[model samples]
Target: MKSTPLACAFAALFFPVIASAEAEPSGVRTNTARLMTTDAAEVIDAPVLGLQRTAIPLFAGLAVDTSLYADALLAPNLGLRWALAAGPHRVVLGARYTHFVGASTYSGIVESEAPAIQSFEPELSGPSFYGVYGLVLGPIQLQGEARYGHYTTDYLSFTGGAGFNFAGHWSVVAEAGVRVEGGSAFRAAAGIRYGGEGLGFGLGAAYVDLSDPALPGESLPVLPVLDLSWTFR
Candidate 1:
């Protein structure tokens, strides 16, 4: 069958293969690295593994990255992250004010998990700040982050991850994080990431224990790790 030009154009416009000129993998890349930007900065969403984020460049050596996925209940959140310019061999430094918030600001009564009733309202928005550091190698990226915040609960978590670009626009990524303060919580995931000049996607399976963290042999949540983003350079 002969394909029409219109069909080809439509496919090209929306289904182009994902690829990027930069490291593309998630990490705190150095300023000296190719296409270096805070676009790789860590957000509170998936922590070490990050999630959908947008980095608005504010200066030559700094950019602010924020994400809304950090809060599962859509609680009012504010996250600020800065990527301090550094060389590829040096650590890229930055910080977050808080994560972003979306809707759910009204006050009302809600149901609890125990079949209990409860009321909800916005509080004085707690303090949430984080320090991020990352380094980029040609096809390898590494990052570490620590965050302190309290929304429904208080936590201080440390996370570190590594990514290896094994093929064009494809990378193998793994991350592990733990909350040492407030309570014992743990998360670890290994997945693949895809990136184009602007769009990116991530998928993997993760183990998340929010209360007393213990590894369950075969009982794992499906689709625990998922990320999708379209960034504007």
Candidate 2:
């Protein structure tokens, strides 16, 4: 199973912001930042796959984050992230591995009598390295990240948003951003979240407009997204 370009795109585009923005204020320090993000794109229309993520503080201004997820197709993915903070900015380095365990056919139809059938490849995995800069200006936050992976894939993502605190314990958050990947792949998303001091949930929607390598001259339309996460400090 060749890694879906769409999945790579989603990871490169959204994870940085999700990880950096959710860290508690106390967790931020020079050379030490704890970041955690989930790969939830597979859950949009597929079966309910579980995601497990954890962050461990190693020492002064250094931390490690890891995640594992499996989808309905039985494709398993693993990722590890190392983060270091410099003043108000965070530097992130990570790698991912994905195993495609199921068989798939290129064509939709299958006939029992057919003697020969094409089989898709059984694995797609690679390493990725990226960096993120986070700045808080008054009540708003700004973030930007750039990533490069195997197969010459490159991505740049940007996000700007703010959170509102009201009623002492309630808060509302909104964000919007654009991701440009591989020079030709483009996507955009906006989302709103509500939560308290230690927990939060969110709903997001995105539109992907990019050339499909498998289908020449074809492009995909808007896609829906949903995500939820909690923090313990």
Candidate 3:
């Protein structure tokens, strides 16, 4: 089966588990949550991962940022982003790279009297380049991203979302995106968030459709999403 670039990108962002830690924020702080859906016939179940992004001013309107993520199914991934702040918007260009650690695989079928066996295999790794733009228009926020990379195969992805702040500490967000590699998949999510002043968390649900020529037509109806982050200044 071929893996779509969107699927690989989602796996890289959300499936990893990371220890919660605090960081001192001297510059602009931004954190995001992403949903990841494992391939329908893949070995592992879908998992949610949190993303932390920090921007340190390099000059007047330019800053440099970095991101790190890890999970049991994949190796530690790191990325660097270059950001420029405009009047009421921000633009970012970044690149991410990750290596595949071996994953534990289980037999598809188990005998009634025998235990299921597990095995492992290391997969290919590669890098991706992405661009993002964010716009703030008084109580509404809009964001979009495009990415392309190679990881065992070549893939491309596009995602866009919007958020509405109804209260000082409450907001609702919705996003939809698609990815194409050897095949294509679609994903959508909606959720609510709470927090202010460099700290926030959110809970949401996502749906994924992996109905591509290279994959069995499978869909994840509802997957949970958890996001947490803190920043210091």
**For model 3, how does the per-residue alpha-carbon lDDT over 1-233 read when each residue is reduced to its tens digit?**
99999999987886553321222112212233222221100001112123433334444333343333343445556555556656668676767677666343322222222333232233547787887787766667677878888876788888787777676657777878888764347767887776455565777887754343322344455678665755432
Q: All predictions: root-mean-square deviation over Cα?
A: 11.5, 17.0, 18.2
Candidate 1 per-residue lDDT over residues 35-59, each given as its tens digit: 1111243322212223545445555
Best candidate, TM-score: 3
List TM-scores for all candidates, in order.
0.60, 0.54, 0.62
Measure candidate 3: CA RMSD.
18.2
> What stretches of model 3 exceed 4 Å from their correct place?
1-69, 104-124, 210-221
Per-residue lDDT for 79-155 in model 2, tens only?
55555545544445556555545434323333232335343243334555555555643333445555555533445
Best first by lDDT, ranked: 3, 1, 2
- Output the better candidate (1/2) by lDDT: 1
Sorted by TM-score, highest first, which candidate order results? Answer: 3, 1, 2
Runs with alpha carbons beyond 4 Å of true place in candidate 2: 1-54, 61-63, 66-75, 84-87, 102-119, 151-184, 210-219
Predictions in order: lDDT: 0.53, 0.43, 0.54
